[model samples]
Target: MHRIAVLLVEPVVGFDATIAPTLFGAAADADGTPLYEVVTCGLSRAAVTTTNGFALLPAAGPEALATADTVVVPGTRYAPARSDGVLQPELAAALAAIRPGTRIVSICTGAFVLAAAGLLDGRPATTHWRFADDLRALHPEVRLDENVLFVDDGDVLTSAGLAAGIDLCLHIIRSDHGAAVANEVARYCVVPPWREGGQAQFIERHMPADPHASTAATRQWALDHLDEPLSIEQLAGHANMSERTFCRRFREETGQSPGGWVRSRRVERARELLETHDLPVDEVARRAGLGSGGNLRHHLRRGLGMSPSSYRKVFQGS
Candidate 1:
């Protein structure tokens, strides 16, 4: 089993600290065999304080990092890293214990720690949007994309605030085991199975004074009708709004234009069909609203860098 060590620093965001262990621990093979060994550790055996009122007693100390196949640093309010962009000697030493080439991850403001240690230099990353400016000012060498929910730059991954940590954990599970295992874990945890890493971290929308004026219902309608051509005028008609109003409200609610959202959803639908059904590629493409196998291949390759057959083989393991 792969061993995952979650490294907690003082003043950690309690929510972020729990995400990895909770999600990874829930993952198991079809026979109910646990897939990963998750352990929590801190710099020392002492109780580690959290941003929340309570503290956590780690199962081990920094020495555990040496044996980990992956190391996760949860968000912390450690001033040296958060403010000065430098790791304190002890924290630096603790990180140094991690074996070289071990995959590293950060949740929320934990990106600060990784950036400070120079692990994120020249690497794409993200953190809590509220701190993106601070991170940029302190570490200009890092490619900070605060707009997305997370950044998966191969060996090093980082997520945005709070619940985004859950998304990143699910993403890791999916990458390691496959979408089926990740979906099972998500079902057990009662969270959404997937949220693309490129999705916006937050939608800046002013709630309409009349709630009935929202486009949420129309979005749901679009989802159900993904197999059919969904023109803006048709969607606007369903939402009982003019095309102009519908387009404005749709972008506000979803952070994407109507066409872009539909394309992404179609790709997602194609992926799901590819994974769960062994239908012919053209059939899957038609059901997903991509129109043809060639169209599906174009979108899948552009978005996921894989073809439909390749995706099915990877996720379905056949």
Candidate 2:
């Protein structure tokens, strides 16, 4: 089995530390055999206090890092990296114990640790959106894109916050095994398997608290009619609003234009068909309102960074 070691620095965010083992530990093959052996480790084989006032006794220490195929560093509140852009002495030594070529992952501000160790230099990375400015200020050399949920920089990966870590872990599973395995894990965890990493971390959703003010019904109708050609004017008419009012409200509610939202929904439908059905490309495109195979390929490539055939190949049986 692949061995995964979760390294927890002192004052660790308890929720962040549990995510790796909780997801990866639950992954299994068709025969119900565990795929990864996950262990929690600390600076020593002793108890460490969490930021939430609880103590956890780890099964191993820094020594486990050398044996791990993947090393995960969860967010920690007390790491020197947060303040000084440097690793603590013991933490640095512990990080040094990791074997070469081991996959490195950081959840939330744990990116701070990897950045401090210079592992994320010249690589795309992200942390919590709220901390993006601080991280950029501290480690200007790291290519920080705070808009996305996660960054997959080959051997090094970083996620935005506690929840985005789930997305990153699922992505790692998909990358390592395949979409089928990742989807299975996601199902077991009761979460969505594939949220494109490029999706915005913060959407400008102003809740339509007034029942009469919501464009929700019109949006749902548009989804139902995606196979039919949709137009902004038609959508505005459906919502009983003028074209200008509808466009403004749509952006405020969904953080996307009407046309953009329709396109995205069409792409999503196409993706689902590609992953779960055996239909031909053109048929899938027609069903998804993408018009033709060429159009489907264009949208998938531009929106998802892959072609229809490649996407199907990765997820057909998933």
Candidate 3:
């Protein structure tokens, strides 16, 4: 079994700390056996208080990091990394216990810790949108993209606030095992099986001036007809609005233009088909509304950095 060490520092985000165990612990094998051994460790073998006014008595100490295959650092207000852009001596020492090449993850402001440790320098990363400016201001060496839900920088991963942590954890499971296993875990946890890391972190969702007017119906219609040729004009007509009005409302609700949103959804649908079905590339592309196998190949490569066959091989063990 893979060993996952959740390292908790003082004043940690209570919700962030629970995500690893909740999802990873729920992962099971074909026969329903656990696949990961998750343990919570503190800077020392002591009780750690959280920002929620509760305390956690960790099951292990920093020594656990020495043998962990993956180490997760949840957001914490107590880490000096959040402010002065450096890890506290104790925290630094505990992190140093982790063996080389151990996969590292950060949830929300937890990116600060990784950034302070120099683990994120010269790497693409992200944090809670609210703190993106501060993180960049403090650690310019870290290439931070605040728009996405998470950043999977090979061995080092960082996510936006709260729910995005769950997304990252599920993504890790998918990468380590397969989409089927990750989807099962997600079902058990009552969360969506997949939300691409490229999805926007923030969407301006103010109510339209006319309360009854919305692009929701049109968006749903587009999803149902992904295999059909969808254009902004058609979508605008369905929404009973001018093209300009539909475009503005779509961005407000979904944080993306119509063309971009359609392409992303098509790519996502293609990914699902690739992972869960055995259709030929041409057929998959047709079903995903990408016109042809070559189009599918181009979209998949551009969006996910992998070809259809490569993606299928990774997910379904084809």
Candidate 4:
């Protein structure tokens, strides 16, 4: 079994401490057996107080670091001197105790701790968007991308604020378990399973100011007819324009091509039903408009590099 050690520093916030165990601990094969074990550790084996006024009894100390396949540092209230991007000395030493090549993850301001240890130098990472500017200024050597929900840089990973930590942890689960197991874990945790590293962090759709020119109707119509054979020609006719003009209009409205938008939504729907229902894969294919499990497998592989059964295994609501 894979072992993950979550390092809790002083004044551990409630949110970060809970993400890893829930995500990693839920990983299992079809037999309903555990695939990974997560241990919560601290600088020492002490009662670590949380920001919510609760105290936690850590199961291990920094010695856990040497045995950790992955080490995670979560947000703390002890950021000082360096402001939003500072790390305390004891926390720094605990980080230093981690074995080399151990995958390191940071939740919210925990990126500050990794940054201080120089682990993030010249690496792309993100923290909470609210403190993104400060993180950038403090560690410009570490490329700070503020728009992604999380950044997966091989050995190191970093996430946005509190809830995005959920996304990041789910991502790590997906990486470790393949899409099947990760999807199940997401269902168990009530989170999305496989948001890619490149997805927009939080791009809100702009409601049409001029409803007359809006693409909402076209999008809705496409969703309603995902099973039917629909193409740019059909959508353009619905919009009453040449295919080329309709294509331009669609991209302008959604920041992605019509095909890309349709594909993403299909995958999204497939994911939802996979997590919420136990329908036969072919039925799921029909509902998601992917035709057959074979076809679903084809597209899922092209879009997510996994099969439908595999994706369902990970994302299914447990």
Candidate 5:
């Protein structure tokens, strides 16, 4: 059995701890042989409280991590560790005890925990999009990528907030085993087998109560015409605003520009088409509105660091 350890901290987020077991635990070979043994541990044996209402009775302490092939850090409650970037003594010590060469994975603000322990320093990683600026300010040495759903920097991996954890977990399964097994796991978990890490993290903020107080309509229209050739001016015309005002409002409402949003949608469409169909690369490019396969390759390479064919072969299966 591959021993996987989940390190639960004080006020841990339930979703984070649940990720490993729900995905990797549920994973099985074609004959239903479980591929991984998951263990949840904390600083001590006491019941660990979660950000949610409940607490959990952990089966072990830091010792559970002693022989783990992988150690996972779930997101914790908002504290100085989250904002000011302080580390509790116990958490730091627990992290220090991790076996050498063991894979370390973080979910959402769990990146804060790894950063607090100095593990993320001088490494490329990411966390919840909302916290990217704060993480960057405190940990200047770390290479922060705000756009990715997760980052696989060899021994360490970090994922964006909430559901992106699923993407990272599925990615790990694919890397450790292969796409075929990972696809089975995804089917078991009701998730896509492969999600490009470069896929934009959906970081929408709550809009005002007044229906009139949103740019949602314009964004909706943009989505409807994602495959259409669009320019900033055309989007501005739809919003009934000048270029400068539209640009400002667009950024505030959507957290991205018209062009950036369109490009992201194109990439997402290409990824889906690549995985679900056997269309020629050129047709995939045409449907995704990337003009041609060469153009699609350029954008995919820029965002995902892989050629379209290479990406499809890796994730779409034989």
Candidate 6:
């Protein structure tokens, strides 16, 4: 099994620290075999304090990192990294023990640690939006995009605050074991299986004055009828609102234009078909409302860096 070591720096963001172990620990093969061995480590074998008014006793010390296939750093209030973009000697020594080429992940403000260690320099990453400016000022070499839920740059990954860590974890699970295993773990955890990493970390949506005027119902309807052409006027009619109002409300609520959202959903549907069915590319595209095989190939290549046939081969292990 692959080994994952979670390094909990002092003053850790409690919720962020548990996400990896919880999500990765829940992943198992169809025959009930666990997919990964997850262990928690710290600078030393000591009680680590957290921002949540509690502390955690890690299962191991920095030595655990030397053998990990992957290392995760959860959000922390450790000042040197969080504010000064510098790693303290002890923490630096601890991180240096990690093997070269091992995957590294950061959740929320944990990106600070990675940035401080120079691990994120010239790499695309993200962190809690509230601290994005601070991160930028502290480490200008890092490519920081605070708008998205997560940024997966091959061996290095980072996520925005709080729940976005869940999205990143599920993404890793999907990448490692395929969507089916990830979906099963998601079902067990009672969370959505997928949220595109490019989705906004936060949307400034105001509550609709009239509940019935909201475009939620229409969005659900759109999901149900993705196989059909969905015009803005038709969707507005379903919500009993004018096209302009519908468009405004839709963007406010979902942080994406209706057309963009629809296209993403169609691409997602195409991916599901590719994974679960042996349908031809053109048929998959038509059923996904993407028009044809040529279009499907274009979307898949653009979104996933692979063609439809390659996607199927990977996800279905064919």
TM-score of each: 0.93, 0.81, 0.91, 0.71, 0.69, 0.96
At residue 139, what lDDT does model 1 achieve?
Answer: 99
Candidates, ranked, TM-score: 6, 1, 3, 2, 4, 5
Query: What TM-score does structure 6 among the candidates reach?
Result: 0.96
Q: In terms of TM-score, which candidate is stronger, 1 or 2?
A: 1
Q: Would you list the C-alpha lDDT of every candidate in the order shown?
A: 0.91, 0.86, 0.90, 0.78, 0.82, 0.92
Q: Specify the poorest-scoring 10-residue window by lDDT in model 5.
A: 203-212
Give per-residue CA lDDT, model 5, range 141-254, as digits (tens). Answer: 889998889999989999998889999999888666655677787887788666567666874544645656466787778767766777888888887778887777666665
Count of clashes, each model: 0, 0, 0, 9, 0, 0
Q: Which pairs of residues clash in candidate 2, taking residues 3 or more apart in a chain or in different chains?
A: none
Off by over 4 Å in 4: 81-86, 205-318
Task: Write model 6 residue lDDT over 1-318, tens digit each, in one string.
Answer: 999999999999999999999999999988999999999999999999999999999999999999999999999989998778899999999898889999999999999999999999999999999999999999999999999999999999999999999999999998887778888989988998887898888888846888897888888899899999999989999999899999999988877888988998898788888889999999999999999999999998887798999989997889
The regions of model 5 sitting more than 4 angstroms off are: 1-4, 14-39, 51-53, 59-70, 77-102, 126-140, 143-155, 159-205, 208-213, 239-241
Candidate 6 Cα outliers beyond 4 Å, as residue runs: none
Error of 3 at 95 (Å): 1.4
lDDT of 1 by residue, 1-318 (tens): 999999999989998889999999999998999999999999998999999999999999999999999999999999999889999899899888888899999999999999999999999999999999999999999999999999999899999999999999998987777777888999999998877788888887847778999998888898899999999989999999999999998888767788888888888788778888999999999999999999999998886688888889988889
Show where candidate 1 strays beyond 4 Å: none
Candidate 3 residue lDDT tens string, 248-311:
9888977778998898778768878888899999999999999999999998777568899999
CA RMSD (A), model 4: 6.2
- The order by descending lDDT is 6, 1, 3, 2, 5, 4
Candidate 5 whole-model C-alpha lDDT, 0 to 1: 0.82
